[model samples]
Target: MNRISATRSELLARRAGIRLAIQGRDLLKEKRTALMREFDRLSADAVAAMQDLEEKARRARASLSEAVALEGPEAVGSAALAARNEIGVRLTAKSVAGVKIVDLEHDPVGRARTDRGYSLAATSPRIDTAAEGFETVVEVLLDFVAVELSLRRLAEEITRTTRRVNALEHVVVPRLEKERDFILNVLNERELENRVRLMRARSRTDERARQTGGLAERSPA
Candidate 1:
């Protein structure tokens, strides 16, 4: 803290500072509340997404193993290679409480049998089933990733909002109030001292007049 003057200007400035800080704190509180709500909603979504991803992955793994055992590893590998396509992901930015989060979108993962370069006629049905199972897993994984990423960003924003609220409530506002109190006390004391000095001056003037009047009466006029 720096040395402060006991002037009306300083007092007014401190009062304004306190007012603005309180408003800011209130706004931050609102933001934190909103952010928490969003986090909670997304948290539930993330949990369900994770569960779905796990289940899909488990089924995909089993399917792949069965395919390899029945149709041979070479056939499964060739099918995977033929089905390969570039996944174009589109990311858009969205804001929550001044924090930026991304919205992820992508083209569909699973292709029709005719769309893929592979032919169902050439491959065993087991191989096709295995490929479709893995494709389904990929779809679930993308959803899980999106939810998790948003959750992470929201968590960070919540932390920052909490810190700001604490600083205002605990530190900045208190300091300003203390300074305002100091200034108010000093002004009151100065006012009291001026009043006492004025009263003393009036008493001395009254005593001098009385002495003058008594001397005139003694002088015989």
Candidate 2:
């Protein structure tokens, strides 16, 4: 009786375990799908950001070239040096959904520009041209850094999420399923044995009662 009871208990436990494992697997799959979709969206955004950076870089370079052509090299160089002293770029980190980005600020470039910006002290046209080119190069470098950092953060987050999903699907779910099956098999065997024993005991009790009646009838009463 005890064995039968234990077996029944084990069977119930196994069934519950199987149910929970299945539910967990389904939930993990859903999470994985959501993460993948996010990764795709981030990738698209990164591509667009790169394109925008490139376009801005080209514009900056062209502006510098025109400035140098009009003024001499010496003039442009002096302006660039003055701009450096007067202008400052600062980068600050901002977070969005656990990702961090460098936000750049140019303090001097737009701050002091009157109707006509600071005059270049020109020595030669070539030098002026080079000075203009330098400004464009600086702008391009700043844009590149921002885009690269953004992409790096996104990629790292995607990798971390993927690893967690794989672990749930391949490791945790399978182990739970295997344990549940083992418990079920053990319970079924115990149940069958209990049934057989109960039948045998009932047959013995019936035979004893019949013998007692025969003895009583045979005696001189």
Candidate 3:
């Protein structure tokens, strides 16, 4: 490491820098803690959402199999082609502990037979059951994605904050403190040297004066 200048002003500046670094480190530590908390919460949410999605998916698969068995694959394909793509997804942003995350909004899925945009007379009950089950799966999957995304962002922020805190605490702050100590020692040494020089000069002046007085007192006139 390069040596710091041993000046009083330099020492003061180093001390101030260390103080600011310490304050910044503390704030980062707090931020890391908060992000970790949010991450944990989101993680739990994601897990629950995943479990729900899995169950919904299983049910949807079973219902689809039943529909295929009852109405035959050809009828189910015809029904799927007739169905309208009416699902609307709207996303909004939210902040969690300074991290931004996404929220979702959409039209309600799995409506009544009249609202399903398909003719009830044409579609069998098994087909309707399969449609509703699949829609539930999609909804739950969307929720799961949102939760997982938020968790990922929070985890990244927490890692970044932790790195910053460690750098300040272990590297920058310690270097500044060492520089401050070095400058102080230098200043003290200079002060002691100056004091010693001044004392020696004063002693020489007193000796000269005393010798001149003795000569004057010894003279006859």
Candidate 4:
């Protein structure tokens, strides 16, 4: 432990530092609270989205299986290849309670049969139904993915902010306070020592003056 100077200047500096640390701690606490709120809200949303995605996925798989059984696997695969489209996504950054996360944008899926790139005459109704189900599943999955990613980012930030708050509360402020108290004690000790020395010096001076007056009295006038 490094010893701080036992001076008024050092004391003032330490006090100021303590105040700043307190302010920092308060701000971080507020930030942590806000982050937790956001995380909780996002978590609920992500859970719902996940549930929706799962249901849609089950439906899509069932439709695809039925299509395969009716029209054969080779026929469905050919239809999928014929109906493929170039999927694109646009991602942007957004902040929630000081945490930056990604915002996703994409074109709506589950298009009409005319838009699926496969011809209605060439493909069976089962293939079209299967394609629609799968497209809906993809749409729900994208939404779920975005929510999950945001939740993860928010959780990480909350953890980081909480750690900082803990450090200030448990470590930094207490140490500075201890140092300030140490300085105060040292200054008080020095003041007491100085007072004692001054009192002793004054007593000696008075005794010597009295002795000199007594010697003068004994001499002839």
Candidate 5:
């Protein structure tokens, strides 16, 4: 610890620092509270999205199984090969509580039977059912991932803010208070010492005056 001067100036400066530290702690506390609220709200949505994603995946798998049974593995494989298309994903960004949130934007996944790239007459309708179910699953999966990412960012921000608040409250403000108290005590002691010295000096001066008066009184005439 750097020892501060035993003066009023250092005491005032320490007091100012203490006030700023307290204000900073309060602001960070507010930020933490806001982050928690947002996280709670999005966490609920994330749970529902996860459940929906699981259900969609299960249904998609069942439909694929039926398609394979009804239309032979070779035929289904041929259709899958023809219908395989690269999915385009468009991503955008937004901010919430000083955190970056990623948004998933894309075209609708469902398509008409004619649009599936396979000859409608050759492919069983079961293939289309399976394809549609899986596409829906993909869409929901995207939504679920987006929510999970947001929650993660919020959690991180909350942690950082909490740390900052703790540092100010536990470390910074207390240190300043200690320094201020030290300065105050030193100044008080110095003032007391000066007063004692002044009293001794006055006493000596009064004694010299009394001695001179006694000599004058004892002198002849």
Candidate 6:
């Protein structure tokens, strides 16, 4: 009887364990889904930002080349200085879906044209044009770097979360469930055997009592 009771208690405990494991599996799955969605959105945004930076860089280079050819290197330098003064670079930090991105600044300045319509100090038109063109290129590169880094970091985090979810769903949770089931089955079988044994014992006891009563009556005392 004691063994049977112990088995019954074990079965109850196993059932509880199964319930907890199942709940954990469900929660982890939800978290994985959310992380995947975030990863997708972030990846898309990073691609778009890279394309925009590239396009802008190309246009800036073209403009610088035209200005240098018309006015000379001196004019290009003046324009660059002016652009820098007019529009200074400003940085601001931003967070997207728990990922942090440093803010970027884009400031382009054009130099004033000389009386002769040439650059003030530099005479090489090609040199001036190249310098102007590179300013835009530099900005584009910076933007690309920021986006790429953020994307890489976000991807890493996503991968980590996914692994954890898979582990819980495929390995940890299943093992727990199997063990719980085994315990319950063992408990049930033990209890059933105990019930059968008790019935047999009770039957024997009743038969013995009846035989004793008959003997006592027949013996007349």
Candidate 4: TM-score?
0.91
- Candidate 6 stretches with Cα past 4 Å from truth are 1-20, 56-119, 123-129
Query: Per-residue lDDT of 1-221 in model 3, one digit per residue for the tens?
Result: 24567877898899899989999999898888888887887788888888888888999999999999989999888877777577788889888668898777777776776776677898889999998898788888877777787887888888888889989999999988888888888899999999999999899999999999999999999
| Local accuracy of candidate 5 as per-residue lDDT tens digits, 1-221 | 35468788888999999999999999899888888998998999999998898899999999999999999899889988888776777878787667787788777777788877998999878999998998899889877877888899899999999999999999999999999998989989999999999999999999999999999999998
Q: Which residue pairs in model 5 clash with each other?
A: none
Taking all chains together, each candidate's TM-score versus the true structure is 0.92, 0.62, 0.88, 0.91, 0.89, 0.66
lDDT comparing candidate 6 with the true structure? 0.64
> For residues 1-221, could you state the per-residue lDDT of candidate 4 as single tens digits?
35567899999999999999999999998988888888888888888888888898898899999999999998899889988886688888777777877778888887888998877887888998899999988888877778788888888888899899989999999999999999989999999999999999999999999999999999997
Question: Which of the two, 1 or 6, has more TM-score?
Answer: 1
Candidate 1 lDDT, 1-221, residue by residue in tens: 25789999999999999999999999999999989998999899888888888898898999999999988888888888998888888888788888676678988999877777786787887877788898898888877777788889899989999999999999999999999999999989999999999999999999999999899989964
lDDT of each residue in 43-141, candidate 2, tens digit only:
676677667657766766776676666765566666666545444677788664455655666643323232124453424444444445555456556
Highest TM-score model number: 1
Query: Which residue pairs clash within candidate 6?
Result: 75-119, 78-111, 79-110, 79-111, 83-109
Score each candidate by Cα lDDT: 0.88, 0.60, 0.85, 0.88, 0.89, 0.64
Badly placed stretches (over 4 Å) of model 3 are 1-3, 209-221
Runs of candidate 2 exceeding 4 Å displacement = 1-35, 59-76, 85-118, 121-151
- Local error of candidate 4 at residue 132 (angstroms): 1.0
Cα lDDT for residue 6, candidate 5: 73
Report RMSD (Å) for each prediction in the order shown: 1.8, 5.8, 2.2, 1.9, 2.1, 6.0
Ranking by TM-score: 1, 4, 5, 3, 6, 2
Evaluate residue 66 in candidate 4 and report its C-alpha lDDT on the 0 to 100 scale: 98
TM-score of 1: 0.92
How displaced is residue 19 in candidate 1, in Å? 0.4
Instruction: Tell me how far candidate 3 lies from the true structure as C-alpha RMSD in angstroms.
Output: 2.2
